[model samples]
Target: MSKEKLFKVAFMNQGKVYELHAREVNQSGLFGFIEIGDFVFDESSGIVIDPSEERLRSEFEGVLSTFVPVHSIIRIDEVKKRGNNKISDLPEGANVTQFPSPIYTPGKGKND
Candidate 1:
């Protein structure tokens, strides 16, 4: 008998933090993207209705795999059991900052 592996991935998107679970997490062939698959969730547990979990489920529904940018990733951890997958707003006064946008236009350079 072998124990299965599970991973909890946390990442930043726009101005929010997204937490999800997966069986596999690895660097993808695509540049600057991380590949994630085998999403896990509590499909049978209907005791409580969680909007966050429901949103995640709907967002990922029918999707076999996904690619996330490395810069947006906050952390990844291997866990013994799956927890409530969720999306949350970034806390105020947080030290971490998002990637900056380009200041200069491609064709219209500063000199032009």
Candidate 2:
């Protein structure tokens, strides 16, 4: 995928901007409108927050109170990046070989 690829999803709860990939967004039991910048996971705690009404109230001021299923997402985009090579173009066959690097050898007869 291209690095520039991004999605402009609407945050059903809060109006914030977060550029992300469709794959990165985890959609499971979600139900209403998916907010753009809202996160399903807690950043600091690194915990998955349940998208429920009660959970939303305790965490983000009723934000994400409505479950927006992943299916609700509409806008999706492609990212652009360099060196995007196909798997078939990669070198294969018996010609492949590994080379030793001089960086591994250190002074005083020591190997780094």
Candidate 3:
């Protein structure tokens, strides 16, 4: 029997860090983006509920595929088993910085 493959992806979004598991993670044809699909979430096992995880589930509900900017990706790992998927606030004093978008001026020369 063959085991199913799973990947854990962590990335930054809206000043928060989102951690999720997916069956597919690949570099997208769209420049500077990574494609993720088949999001995995923990089923309700007991009465214990995590609001943060619920929010993550709701946010990804009905999402077929997501394209995340390469710069926003924190890490990707191939794991033997899936873990609790959740979203978290960026840790205090974290060294990671978000990538800045380039500024453009209409009809302005490159040297201007």
Candidate 4:
């Protein structure tokens, strides 16, 4: 028997921090994105349901795979088991921000 791999991916989106578990995490073919697939959630908690988990489940429902920009990704780790996935607001004055791509520089040429 072989054990499966589970990944915990954390990222920032719209000023909120998101953490989730997935079976697949790989570098996307796109220029600057990561591919994630096979979301995992526990549904055997019985009568009680966590709002955060429910929210995440609904948000990812019907989603086969998702791509997140490399810069937005905070961290990725391989875990032995899945945890409760949730979204959290960025702390006050948190230094987290969307990575800005350099499109142009407004200085004189290097040769100048």
Q: Residue-wise lDDT of candidate 2 within 1-112, one digit each (tens)?
A: 6653333233212222222322233333433334333333323443654334234335444353334434333344443321211111113444432232332344775562
On TM-score, the candidate that comes out on top is: 4
> What is the descending lDDT order?
4, 1, 3, 2
Model 2 sits at a Cα RMSD from the real structure of 19.5
Q: Model 1 — TM-score against the truth?
A: 0.83
TM-score to native of every candidate shown: 0.83, 0.21, 0.83, 0.86
Question: Local distance difference test, per candidate?
Answer: 0.89, 0.33, 0.89, 0.89
Q: Report the Cα lDDT for residue 88, model 1.
A: 96
Instruction: For candidate 1, write residues 1-112 as lDDT tens digits.
Output: 9998999999988788999999989999987789989999777767778999999999999988899888888899999999989999977898776875543446767777
Tell me how many clashing residue pairs each candidate has.
Answer: 0, 16, 0, 0
Candidate 3 residues 72-97, lDDT tens each?
A: 89999999898988888877998777
Candidate 1: stretches off by over 4 Å:
100-112
Model 3 CA deviation exceeding 4 Å by range: 101-112
Cα lDDT of model 4 by residue, 8-106, tens digit: 999988888999999999999886789999999887968988888899899999999999988889999999988989999988978867867843556
Check candidate 4 and list the clashing pairs. none
Better of 1 and 3 by lDDT: 1
